[model samples]
Target: MTNEIYMTSKAWPFDQARAILRRLDIEKKRGIDRGDKPVVFETGYGPSGLPHIGTFGEVVRTTMVRNAFIALTEGKIATRLICVSDDMDGMRKVPGTVPNPDELEAYMQKPLTDVPDPFGTHDSFGNHMNARLRAFLDSFGFDYEFMSATELYRSGAYDEYLLRALNKFDDIMKVMLPTLGAERQATYSPFLPISPSTGRVLYVPMKAVNPEDGTITFDDEDGTEVTMSVTGGNVKFQWKPDFGMRWAALGVDFEMFGKDHQDNAPLYSRICKILGGNPPVQFVYELFLDEKGEKISKTKGNGISVEDWLKYAPPESLSLFNFAKPRAAKKLYFDVIPKTVDEYYQHLDGWSRQDEKQRANNPVWHIHNGTPPDENPPLTFALLLNLVSAANASDTETLWGFIKKYAPDATPENSPGLDRLTHYAVAYYEDFVKPNKAYRDPTDQERAALEDLVKRFRNVSAAESNDGEALQTMIFSVGKDHEFENLRDWFKAIYEVCLGQSQGPRFGSFVAIYGPEETADLIETSLAGNLS
Candidate 1:
């Protein structure tokens, strides 16, 4: 059977992550050598909001590292991409721009299960967001185990862990209480304790019933019932300690989080240590920026999603963007998307060039998990399209055939360079692939030059009428014969005269690859712009 390339690798550019992995690998081997269970990397996300581009970067990196470990072991060793959804996280505030945002704030400090999804199809808002993120990951081809907090809570798997953490909740809370905000250790909760008539806080024990209704029953110290009707389980704990207990109980080894969680990392870490479990991969990546350099947030109605970018570029291009260095504070705009994609591929191609010793230790060289491969056809899009159209023509000769029909007296030998066909193809596809604009036209100077060249070509004597070479020499002799900087640049100049654009495909290759008269007809029709 053929071995499929695992699209992941270990030698990534992020130095901190790679260093952590190396240590973890040693630890895992040492445990196994000592006849102990092996530890794996673990990651999770809260499904309270839409999975934005920032989320994509974090998860993609996680997947890349997970696959890298697997590839490192030649598929014999094992690692997992553990995806936990914090569906139990409370609704803080109604995110902005949500359809019917008024109702969300009502569910504040309540489990996500209580809120309705924006789409209103799911049982609750939490379910809707979770489902959307799950769909995005699935479409992205991620292999993972999807676990929801609601189900996990109801399963009783976290019962022991939650109780243990709750026993230590006082000490943990004491540490967090004083250090949390600017206030003292004032706010307190021992798994829903109640204030006595005398004003003393007392504990109120709760239990998750097997056949009991899935809701937390709150009561006063005097035994008067307050309320009931929680989902997931009959028992529950506060947020901070609960998350710590959940990680320990879930056997998560590593997980990266968003920058928003940076402040909470210490609290969670303390909880994990207190509960006798290692914190999972606790890296915090930066956020994504909009065109104006502002952080994108659904509440602000300023976020651009992955689905939006995917409409203009292919998946590979998206992957390329993900693999690029994660900037802590750089803004991403739609205008930069196309150029970045081309530069990414071009860099990959350069890395794969035949110089083995040039960049032997380069991180990007190993980013692809396998030897970097070339993407073929190396032809620009306009040229390719022109080629396709010309290829169907009756006669195939010099690109001059098409040029001659477009500018009957012009010499085709004055064509622009061919080096930029690939670059133009990339830019055009990345930016102009959707809702294509009109053809790039030529400038007045370029048009005058073409007119002069065409007139000279027609006046060529019979002795110089052998082929395009003779025509080329005649045109060259009549003018100063200024050299074009490059093919695309020159074409841009020619196009300004012919079509009015700064860049375009190689006319010669287009007509040659395509055909002569067909290309000529296209030019005559497309470029007949007031050329009296």
Candidate 2:
């Protein structure tokens, strides 16, 4: 009953959520009644490299859509979300993260499941990568079933599908051949025979397939011909065909992939159709890029690592980053983290004040998996950044002491949200802020602007400064007058010229929380070349 009330109360027809629910409804009617099965949602991970931010983005976004479907169905729907690791895949190249690259040359083209663990921890490289992937997602509290292709094929879970693909070899080949280059077309086959001689997965063109006996003949790297059974870990479908086969056998109803796979969409769909399965309702999101605008990669490691970001920011902020305009390619680097954290705080503030029905579009609602927090964090990330310096606080107690002075009503017990930010702010200050605190002699125009802005701030009555909204407005107006292009730079100057870094908390909130009198002194210090 509670679920129904929650579902019916929110605005339906939310862009992504509505689209997901609509497609899920169609799948239930078509696949369950007509096609005869439960709906499945699957996301694949290539365990060839250590998992990175992109890996998490896929799982988080897909789970979000799955959660929305579950909400709209009000527990009446039965669906499963699975994260499948392609641990059976062969390693084409060694990942940059792994050690002894030259050592792995010997293992090239070997199934990842067969390669030795480079770290000497897990049974194989695949298991090591899979363990890290699972641990990372578990840290974020995702609910998912983990499937290993190594186990799936070795245990014969994919045996029936493998044999069927072999039997229908000609049909699968017809769907795959046109996509290959002329050179590839001549040797193209839908199956890679796992060599019994070298115990390696051979990608060489299949010489023949004895469908009646379910054996595949292929040339080994040494120019020797080998025939192997299509079942029992002896052979596997090539990736495109393998993807479609998973959907057919597993009953996948929905999937979301990155744009790098966009070119393969048509081919994948045709393969799924040829296999008598409908490709799930799909979305292709853009890739995550570094500040240089290059795609983030497991080997390149161009963007922030998962555990590193979690160290300074909340997981919810990372979730917000993923949720924010996912269709557009965005920088997934440290420079984006402060802004994402501030945005998370804004949503929390919005959620606390808005009427329940109005929060249908509030990100905090989605961030919390549709149930937003009952209270907002007392301090924003930007605000806490200021408190760290204003109070010269090296620890929580000292920070709380300053908070109580300006926000007299705040107490540790009542403001648990701020409590979390306090720790992050202090650490961030030491790591990112404190070391960079140096005096930047403002340009004549910048110096004039800073002086005038401080004058206005000093001239304001304590009562006016006490008004949070009014003080923030003054800060923005003065920022533009000083030649800052945007509020971002406005704060950047405030931190760089005044606090000695490129960022800090929301200026107005920080001033209000830090007391207007202390803010005046901080500004004076900046103008006097004493920011250090």
Candidate 3:
């Protein structure tokens, strides 16, 4: 690997915001050179309920660009991944509707803003949601500063910024109201108002004070009652400027947000300038749609959650989808994921085989069919899945040794590597590919092809040929109707013959890479229903 990646490609097709960040980095560094760290970027998220794969996508892309920035400036400048959970934003309703809403009934009728933490120990409902997201980030190996809105408010980090925005409330409001709808502006009790006729600003007054019955007032016009029994305490400013005040106090350099928060960015920018903070970095990613093409949101309850997808799929499979495109509107379903995941990784593998110079510029965006011939073994997850459903190879050491012989580049590190492999294998064996559950069962056509292919494969020796390409081509020859309509049809056919199912793996190449006898044995056991 070289320190410099030649631009074999101009830029990654999926990331325009990254290109913007790179340009901004040059400007940021001019400031950093004079002895300022210039915290380069920050992104905001809401912890109202269960986090989704889309959430992971936002953070992962942020982290990758941060890594690029750190690389670009040679470590002179610093960037941080600040996961700001808008816990202080009023909680509208319990997201999932727990069976025991009564159990949480005590928390109702309070400012729908601050409900009790579902996990019971956290100070508020927002904290509970933030904790869930934090757990997922930790599981994904992201390094970030996890901050809760409630903590920042209680700690008074936003005190100075808040006071400044409050003082300039009228000026900031002039810039804010035109952005809200007329009807919204009319009843905009909690929002900053703008003149409908002139779009001139009218600021909402805000302060940090609690009323007699435990209600908290923003500016003395109207106050929200604090649910003291459910949550231990309550303290907040009006939501609009609170975010702007936050951007300044946190030194957030860059943050990517979903489109739902598009209106808030301008307001936050105004508040950032008012509070004397740098305008935080901002990128607006699109939404994740449900199988039916509806946007996934707390109100819709329509999308598959991150936890749900993780149940029967590989982490990288999820990564593949998120990384494959720029954040744009796309349809997703829990079903038929393996077909997509296999194709994606194969495409990645092809990219790895591309000419080195081309591979350097955009390492992650290479097309699979063009990947350079590198020693990088397939992800342990793909290999293990093939083994689980192809043959009865249970010994991790044996598998590792085989991997060393074939692709000496493969590393057997920690449980994550193992877990990743186990997950993919589960998806393959189950033949179903949703977040919650997936099970594999070979079709009649697949079984017939596998039985024939296995008989042909037995005639060859384990060490005779190791080239994956030649092996794949040879297997394709055995099926008279070998012309595949797409990658899915080909993969399904391979799995069928090898494991007595329509799809299992690339048999010829898998056997060559994994070895002949082991490959045969795996297929026999999986087909016999002994391995899954």
lDDT of 2 by residue, 121-196 (tens): 9999999999989998887888899999878888888777777777778888888888889999998887887777
lDDT by residue (1-532, candidate 3, tens digit) is 2124421234342233345455465755766442555554555676665677777888776766666555444455555667877765554455555544656655542332356665566766666667778888899888888877666755767555555554565666676668789866654433322222222222333333222233223332233321221112233445676667666777666667778779778877887787677665577777778787887765666776666666756555675566555457777776546555565556556564566555434435422212323322354344555655443445455456565656665565533444455545555445442222223656766566556666766776544557667767656765555344454665664554344444444555567767755656665665676633
Query: What TM-score does prediction 2 earn?
Result: 0.87
Listing every candidate in turn, what is its Cα RMSD in Å to the true structure after a full C-alpha superposition? 9.4, 3.8, 8.6
User: 117-174, model 1: which lDDT tens digit per residue?
Assistant: 7677899887888888889888988777778776787787766665565456556766
- What 10-residue stretch in candidate 1 is worst by lDDT? 1-10
- Checking candidate 2 for backbone clashes, the offending pairs are 382-505, 382-506, 383-505
Report how far residue 408 has shifted in candidate 3, in Å. 13
For all predicted structures, in order, the TM-scores are 0.65, 0.87, 0.66
Compare candidates 1 and 3 on lDDT and give the better one. 3
